[model samples]
Target: MKRPIRVLVAKVGLDGHDRGAKVIATSLRDAGMEVIYTGLRQTPEMVVNTALQEDVDAIGISILSGAHMTVFPKVMELMKQKELTDVLVTGGGIIPEADIKKLQEIGVGELFPPGTAMKDIVSYIEEWVAENRNF
Candidate 1:
């Protein structure tokens, strides 16, 4: 049998809020993906290292601390340095449209804003894994 899609859901930096991360983790689990959630106040290094260790197909960052700019790029750089080329790096939070475009330009995947449906998030991750991960 094929292994289930694995995702690492993380809250990077000084963001102590994690309710949304928990909700997304549970929703992804219900959608049949294996989820590993790294709890609050994690650094970019910690998140990426954990992703590498967990061998996740995707990394979902929940950043409400307005550090999306710093956090996403740092994670992307680390992912690159660690040779995680196929791992989808996606996230959601209070990021602005321009910032989202900037992040996507730097290789971050589709980012959902607040109020995005859970089904969409699940499907996006599934589709990304299907297209990118070799399984």
Candidate 2:
């Protein structure tokens, strides 16, 4: 049988707040997905490296430091460098809609903003992984 879907939920940069990340991790776990949460103050490289090490199907970054532009692009670049093409690079926080569009254009997956439903996040990850990851 195939192993459970694995997701890496992370808090990047100086975002000391992590309640959302923890909640998502727990919810994903409860939803039957294996979740690895890289706690607060993570760099893009660190987050990507941990995702690689864990062999996760998806990477969920929780950033609220107004660094979405820098964080998402840097992580995307590193993911490409590591050839983690199949891994979903997604995130959520206080990001503007225009910025979300830009990030999506550059290959970042669906980004959730504050107040997005947990069920939506879970379904999005599950659908993306089922279609993309070779699990």
Candidate 3:
């Protein structure tokens, strides 16, 4: 049997609010995906390292401290350095639309904003894994 989709949901860089990250982790678990939540105040390096160690299919960052610009790019860079090319780096928070576009331009995947439906997030990850990950 194929392994379940594995995702590392993280809160990077002093983001003390963890309710959303926990919610996403639980929701993904309920959707039959394995979720590893790294809790609060993680660095980009730490998150990527954990993703590598966990062999996760994706990294879902929950940022509400207005550090999307720095966090996403740093994670992307680390992923590149670690040759985690097949892993999806996607996330959600209070990010502006323009910043989302910019992040996407840098190879970050679809980023949901606040209030995005849980089903949508689940579906996106499912489809992405189906298409991108070689099971």
Better of 1 and 3 by lDDT: 3
lDDT of 2 by residue, 3-97 (tens): 89999999989989999899889999999999998888989999989998999999999988899999999999999999989999898999999
* Global lDDT scores for all candidate models: 0.94, 0.92, 0.95
- Supply every candidate's count of residue pairs whose N, Cα or C atoms clash at under 3 angstroms: 0, 0, 0
Instruction: Kindly list the per-residue Cα lDDT of model 3 for residues 22-119, writing each as its tens digit.
Output: 99999999999999999899999999999989999999999999999999999999889989999999999999999999999999999998899999
Comparing 1 with 2 on TM-score, the higher-scoring candidate is 1
Q: Could you give candidate 1's per-residue lDDT for residues 3-114 as a string of tens digits?
A: 9999999999888989999999999999999999999889999998999899999999998999999999999999999998999999998999999999999999999998
RMSD in Å for model 3: 0.5
TM-scores of the candidates in the order shown? 0.98, 0.98, 0.99
Question: Which 10-residue window in model 2 sums to the lowest lDDT?
Answer: 126-135
Compared with the true structure, the alpha-carbon lDDT of candidate 1 equals: 0.94
> How are the candidates ranked when ordered by lDDT, highest leading?
3, 1, 2
lDDT of 1 at 82: 92
**Regarding lDDT, does 1 or 2 come out ahead?**
1
Per-residue lDDT for 7 in model 3? Answer: 98
Stretches of candidate 1 exceeding 4 Å from the true structure: none
In model 3, the worst 10-residue window by lDDT is 14-23
